[model samples]
Target: EDGSAAWLRYAPLPHDSSHSSLPSSIITLNSTRGSPVYTAQQELRRGIQGIFGKTLNNGTSSNQHGAIIVGTAQAYQKSYGEFDDAKELEEDGYFLSSESNQVLIIGQNERGALYGSFDYLSRLAQGKLGAVSYVSNPHASIRWTNEWDNMDGSIERGYAGPSIFFENGFVTDNVTRVAEYARLLASIRINGMIVNNVNANATLLSPRNINGLGRLADAMRPYGVQLGISLNFASPQTFGGLSTFDPLDPAVDAWWANITNQIYARVPDMAGYLVKANSEGQPGPLTYNRTLAEGANMFARAAKPHGGIVMFRAFVYDNHINESNWKADRANAAVEFFQDLDGKFDDNVVVQIKYGPIDFQVREPVSPLFSTLRNTSTAIELQVTQEYLGQQTHLVYLAPLWKEILEFDMKADNRSSKVKDIISGERFRRPLGGSAGVVNVGTNTTWLGSHLSMSNLYAYGLLAWDPALGAEELLQDWIRLTFGHDKKVIETVTEMSMKSWPAYENYTGNLGIQTLTDILYTHFGPNPATMDNNGWGQWTRADKFSIGMDRTVKNGTGNAGQYPSEVAKVYESIETTPDNLLLWFHHVNYTHRLKSGKTVIQHFYDSHYEGAATAQDLVEQWNSLEGRIDVERFEHVLFRQKYQAGHALVWRDSINQFYYNLSEIKDEAGRVGNHPYRIEAEKMTLDGYRSYSVNPFHTASGAKAIV
Candidate 1:
């Protein structure tokens, strides 16, 4: 199954393991046939059989000595007595404990029991199957994964393989993989998944597609995973034969209501609709001169009747930014778009704001819109796909980045307000809030592009459930579950994953300039030369003397002014801006000194060299554990590690040479643009590079030296 089972591969525990007073029977309460309760009961049986080499009997009526009892709070209250702690649990919270050799996995609802079941199984896999007691509740109401999968079986911005939901422009009949995917998601407490690209097609709303969605829903129902869709806002005109898809138009409203009713009719437990409107040429209410709130409220109104939500994306920006105009900035788009319409949206509409103001940059300031939209529901959108952070080819653990975003203080209302509080509906006391991650999984055997990349998927769910969980700790849990509890394997994989994100950022983009990849291509290679004279709103603004966008309020785009007073002042001046994001806010000279007392150009050189060196060390670390895990996964990870090591050198040299060329400066270490195997400028044509005779940095090198 080549990594397809993911972290659910329940290999047997070590025969000589300590604390092996395992449960003798699996017990359940009020477990109706074909319900989530029954599914959980079956899962525990299957998992215990795989781990313990014994099939435990179902002892619901029998008072077995070492029985694992799993059920809802009501079921437990009916079977035993009322549990006082059961009242403490929220809607999806669970209570797990072991007292007097009896284990209890209880949920406020059936879904929580499933989560508790998985947690108990995870502990068993991690060799912690002993006495324990805890009440686990997710901080956020909605923990969702949005897949950017198209109906054509292609995944947009996807480095993994094709889509698992669709094939040849239609839903695949065999959904065995979908069931497995649901199991994987349920294990991580991921309740909902929007399975299509936000840039949607009209065909997704057709009768055939609706039936297919029902099939998918049926497949996922046992695991308690709800299905959602990304709607094409222009569906009224494109699919309903209406003239104008205006939110204010009664005909358009009727069309949406009809569609919503159809969707809910087919799949009773359909999650909701995710809308990306008036952004990047997607048809939106803006076309009809309607406000974004008006655009979103229509969908919300239609879904409200069915108890569904309308997740309106706040990624609205003019891709063709007037960059020649210095004051024009795309970073201000979301704040400007929804700041005034804060109270205008329906209660069921949640504004899904990206973690950063701009697109998913390697390093970026938290989005100001998060604090500004005080009256509307909001959800912090994160990308687990690694689109700008090495696209899963590079081993980048994203939990650290997400933790920073969730932990940032917004200073709303002249007081401290952390982002996690705001998104969890605690800060504003709003009706709804949560986190949404753009998942990178596909039909690839490894789930992601590589086995190591699965950490991002695992960590996203864990962090969404509890943002306070440390990235390193989450990685440890994932490592134990996926590869068993070998000390060497756990330590080695954790170190590599923990170091990966920082190494990737260091080599690709220092001082938060964002990765200098080619904007037109797949965004995979160094192309600093294309930063200027482009309208993607991602400008480096690198001229002969200085680099970076001057976004301070005084002399530039005034984007810093978007933040609250306390945060605004810090970013408004170069002295207070953090060194990591210095270049993101202010344009600086090549000779300008950072807080670390190094020149901007020198920092670039040193960071890239160090990062590349660290990437090679990752290969070494993985090589040291060659025999620690299964040969298949070990070899697969080794192949990726070797590729990443080689590619890191390419990232290092190309970025170093690009900046060196732009500034016409030599590295203080004499490493940049001074490689011993350098190719001359004349021999560094694109054709020569394509032919593998010249390095991408255009330095003199052997044909075989090119990655």
Candidate 2:
């Protein structure tokens, strides 16, 4: 239950468990000193010891009792017979096969060898070894996570606490927790990491800081995780002391080339740069009248020769709001800006688009830019840090939400174009840069700081590996990995984790209005009133009659036109749109009857109350496991679940009351809708509700972001 260990909880395998008729012995062909392949050998030994109570003997010799042979393809190709062509395993590829007398694990490189070792262990853990004889891979070329931890010892959007990576304006000398994080990433097949904030400063690339990055790279290399940094587009001006950072300027280009080379020299496997440009006041090419592509191209050129790439962000938005007829839609920025230069970007400059168009709201239409650009290399970005999902306090398993977003068919052609296919580079076969998750793991014992939130991390990896996997299957995998093979633990967590998103959807923001967090500052807790004035796309368009953003070409903002013709018509007409995303796509009157037959306003009222009501059920179910599981994690999850059950009530009443007062609609059941409503104190109208006391933040301060 020490979440510090994350998923690396190498516990004793079940004594009654049985292995398939596959590899029982392991042959680790690792002679190269300090190589990732060697590390693989060590890990395999440890894994086999923990899972099967067998210290797998490492050797170059073949075996008869079904042996697992692991090594770089070159070392084993001659002994185990040629691999026909070993060239395809270029980017950390591995091959595994089961035989009557032995099993062979092949690798094109040491990293591949290590990856193969981990794959072997995972199959053993999942008890899926008897079924397949195939190679394992992460589908995305780049699988990474961004941490918004700063050197000042404070994490930007991190809810778990301060930070495990930094303190006192320097990287942490204690690398134990960070090392465990690398293992977790490795176990889940995450290959890259951005160790700092994307709203990055140039000081991070300075000599004092660069060495810190080098040390981090060293710590991660053993686990096959490469280190990437957030690059400042204004680095030439700030760090190199140049008067201008124009991409056309030779000095700017030269400075970046040198920095990239120096980083490569210090850490031969440095993963390259992540750039945030012209977004929310971050300086970029726009200052010099340059296109966003031009800015990203400069670094892409600099890093190309050194085997690096630049992850250019598509999160640009004008921070200052203009009330004029200009009507700048921040939600429309990524598609508007990037669509023009679709084919202009360098091969290495990936357009990292957020999952939703306007930041990581609870529910949003997939970014239209994802469908618009056919030629550019793109990656979908997701947030694992619960900034908008009640931080780590509320257990909102995001797999279901992600499955909805990833499985969305953009209909680029006659074939339904799901977001997963678009980003995975399979639908169009374009070179996909990779997928990144903004997952912050801070100083809390549960690396997410909360034990239950670990589901998000596990799900991110599985989705990154193969977007085709089901959320139900993933939920099971995470449960087994974290809580072990207990059926009750399985059933209990499955119930809670599976329904949490809807539970969250119910209590926080019904009908896709977003978790009504205080929009101006830290995006936490419920604040429904402040949502109206934010100039955000969540324009309810409600007076006394309706609430929703009208996005149709004929009657709305024409945002729906951004999708391809086949897909555009779905959202353009409210009748065809799914009820889950109805409020997000169209403006409706209070009496607007959803397919469910309830009026739009009434649907909101019903769901919020029902959603909060469900939380009590979650609490009751969790309490049943009080003495069944480890008390540490049990108590931790129990307290949080109970806490969330109460928080759900506050969410239900505030949101329900907000809408009820706005439309003057009475609850059909004669539920409590009175002014100064004690949504918590009076739960009698409904048999189910839990209200927790909270000293909620009162004001909204503009200019500060939620991180």
Against the hidden reference, what TM-scores do the models get? 0.96, 0.92
Off by more than 4 A, model 1: 18-20, 62-64, 677-707
After TM-score superposition, the amount by which residue 450's alpha carbon in candidate 2 deviates from its true location, in angstroms, is: 0.9
Clashing pairs in model 1, backbone N/Cα/C closer than 3 A:
677-700, 678-699, 678-700, 679-699, 679-700
lDDT of 2 by residue, 236-339 (tens): 99878899999988888898888888888888888878999988778999999999999999999988987886889999877665423333456677888888
Residue 216 lDDT in candidate 2: 85
* lDDT computed for candidate 2: 0.78
Q: Which 10 consecutive residues of model 1 have the lowest summed lDDT?
A: 698-707
